[model samples]
Target: MMGGPSENPELWAFLESLHCGEFLSGTVTAIERFGVFVALDDGPDHPVFPGVGFISFAELSWQRFEAASDVVQVGQRVSCEFLQFDTWNLEARLSLRATQPDPFQVFADGAAVGQKLHGRVTKLAPFGAFVQVVDGIEGLVHLRELAWTPVETPSDAVQVGDEVTVVVTEIDRERRRLALSRRKGSSEHR
Candidate 1:
């Protein structure tokens, strides 16, 4: 929420301005060996940068993979809950996976199906990709939903530990089947 001089006249009068950490959604602009870059959805030109957050290999997901490329692609949108704003860098630190939601609490709450969620790509497999749904709960994205075409190989579309936006397609409590999909016609996703 960018407040202009007219909206908040006080901002113009003040020589310096103040900013706070707000949970701003974003899209993954780039991915690298170290970390991923996310362009702020609501910001000045959506500056793309690394250090928004880091998903270590161990914390990636439940499935095992050979490399990160198996989980994410070059163009994809990812939603993250802002952790804080770095004053020096003017960047926001975010969490791709839902870490704040305690596992026990979520179990007690009994989250319903079709609940849209934000997640990060941790690993990829031939059948589908694995994502950290919550702190403890991990979900899968079948190859079909990952892209429009038949993904011969998941690595071609995604890499490990990539940030992505997904919606709950199905929830099976007995078998623990959590299916998710990317929103249709995303700008960041090519």
Candidate 2:
């Protein structure tokens, strides 16, 4: 929920002028473990933070990264899409990735079910192993699909960083989900 605007009428007016999904440009003023702050070129100065624009860690990039600094640095110019007004902080919640192309969308455009893809096992879970089919795209090979024979645990068949071949079994663009099957790739696979 949006809190009341600034005490100053001009600040409130500046905040009022903003709309969600609108593109905005700013110079990054600060980079924290939590997020990046940007000083809006056309907006009123923030009363507290270095900038009035805030981009959360999840919105920093489409690609997987260990830290925010890995995606951006202080003093870098950025173009972001306004997500919402953080009334509590009196700042604009922004998305940096919105200004860039979505790797998933690009991948899904040509991706098709039954297509065989080579990927690396990134992580193992009770139900399946996640395989990176492409940059920023990971598909799950369910436990049952691990092999033609019974698989008790994902680690038993695959380990992280292990390169494996898998067949695309399903794709849900709305959910950003991709399902892969090791068994379908080849009957010889373990």
Candidate 3:
């Protein structure tokens, strides 16, 4: 199988010139369960594709959506941040979400420790439950913080979808993480 250098020399040069985080404008060529394809306004003809830019489902948006079409449509114009050169697929790995505002950053900017907020438990893990404190922003409610009493499992404290009151115990903005506590009170109550 051909593996080393790109068979399409022109495409290789174009890809190399593009750097990560560079903005590219394109028309949405196709949308599927996996990703959305874009026909870049720049670049040489793709011998086999109508488009040469790809945005995986995870890179489509910061907000949860039912499908790729929910964020973009065929023939729709879009601006994406270049992520990497996909040698395997000979496509530009791009992110639509990177070009948009991050809800986590915005929330962290205004949030503080010990503040209380109502959130819904969206997922359960062996260690804790992930709660959506705001749209597109979820934080971990550690097993130890599930309650004041000792808890063996996350389910024992709160099941998924439970509306619970939690305290913002920590906010690590550099790591983009929000540590939450499901316990009734802050250290003041202890």
Candidate 4:
């Protein structure tokens, strides 16, 4: 359980045979600030890790959390979609969120262009601001859509944590993108 592949032939074989997109069951073995380690139920001891499976922060859940532990606790059973065999880390890259329904899909189903919504600015970039329209749902307010006047940066119009009202301009369901605008006429209302 603590050594390399030679120490666990069964695990070595199982790890080697795993492919991307395969769904596997595992128990949360350890929780770290960066990610969660899973002891795969169907696999053997990892050569270096406490578990054979690992899920990064982004793959833990669709809903954003302050920490990984907020989403998964040690000893919890989880089914994950195998993203890839992380050769560099010698661990299986897994995504727990993939097995769950996407919140964006649900938001898109009920949202329409020209719908006005109030949301808080979650992040700011030079090009735009990402507004959290709903739990686990964010839409981009492009710099050009930030205001009617020409804007040099997103911060010129909005800052992180600012609650602002915006109109939905475009929703690309396939791409899971929502384009929003603060300026009235800037929105692509259909």
Candidate 5:
């Protein structure tokens, strides 16, 4: 059974009536260029679901994800927020992004420029390692920012799951971006 319906017909009926807000524990049936397909356990039948749910790409996560396959696989189960449902089309919009706090927001609202944060390496790119400040939120530790010495690639200094301290050098909220350095400071050195 889906998370929305726990065998209580009354609760299900009530939930079905007002189809806005978050929905949790949905099943992922497909991953496509347009979006991820999730069959809502609590979603209403055709003609009523259209206006109630929506999933925007921006609201999908706090991390930098290029492809859905990296985090979500076909038939894999995931928790998502029901943003809107198109009842006319019998379609729903869901977002994994809505399920967590934006990392950029956390850095912007609290961590001052140059404040140090401990993060775990989640992914390594040619330029840097993606570090998680918290679940679903990540900032990039660029290769140039890994240490005082030159690093050809990010993997030299840290491997996935390695925990390291990083300083917040810059934040671009509009872009949903963060720049971090591993070097220690009063200077917040790179």
Candidate 6:
């Protein structure tokens, strides 16, 4: 038998009263490729579902990850910031990552220009190569900064999955961007 709002007036009433930006506690009920569903405690039953709250993949964590399971598991308890009422689905839109400290902020706080760090190249583009200095933290090595020699493309100096030692060229905390260089010597290069 399926359960819904009509069958649980008390739960539905609580859900109906929830406003945006509220904080709520819930247990992860399901993890789909698109999002995670949560059975909110002290909340009303969803009009047509088991879970009263849902978190999109982008809201799962501040860090980039491969899957939803990497941030949360079924039955794991989580505290989330209620974003809005999903009127179409009769579910609460929540953000689990909002409750956690941003890893980028942490990395920015300790990082500085001209500091050399070891990283792994994650992607290659015509403009630059993306290297991960830490899990979820990546810096771009522009084609001009790839090496002392002139380069036509990022691949000329670096390839994806290559381990690279890069010097921080710029850190834009507001934009959450770290510019890195692999060149032998430049103003910001080590």
- Candidate 6 lDDT by residue in tens digits, 9-94: 66556667888888999999989878999999887656566598999998988888898988999999999999987655677899
- What is the full ranking by TM-score, best candidate first? 2, 3, 6, 4, 5, 1
TM-score of 2: 0.93
For all the candidates, what are their Cα RMSDs to the real structure?
16.6, 2.2, 2.8, 3.9, 8.8, 4.0
lDDT of 1 by residue, 99-185 (tens): 344343454266655666778887898888888867657778888878766678778777888877777787766665677776442
- Of candidates 6 and 2, the better by lDDT: 2
Backbone clashes for every candidate come to: 9, 0, 0, 0, 17, 2
- Estimate, for each residue in 72-179, the C-alpha lDDT of model 2 and write its tens digit: 888999999999977677788999999888888889899999999999999999999999998789999999999788979998898999999999999988888899
Q: Any residue pairs clashing in model 6, and if so which?
A: 11-44, 12-44
Across 58-147, the per-residue lDDT of candidate 4 in tens digits comes to 899888789887898999999999998765566889999999989999898899999999999999988899999998899999998898
Comparison by TM-score, 1 against 3, better one: 3
**TM-score of every model versus the real structure:** 0.41, 0.93, 0.83, 0.77, 0.53, 0.81
Ten consecutive residues with minimal summed lDDT in candidate 2?
A: 1-10
Worst 10 residues of 6 by lDDT: 181-190
lDDT of each: 0.58, 0.89, 0.86, 0.87, 0.67, 0.85
Name model 3 segments beyond 4 Å from true: 1-7, 184-190
Clashing pairs in 4: none
Stronger candidate by TM-score (1 vs 5): 5
RMSD over all Cα atoms, model 1? 16.6
Residue-level lDDT of model 3, residues 47-132, one tens digit each, is 67667898999999889888787888899999999999998777889999999988888998889998898899999999999999
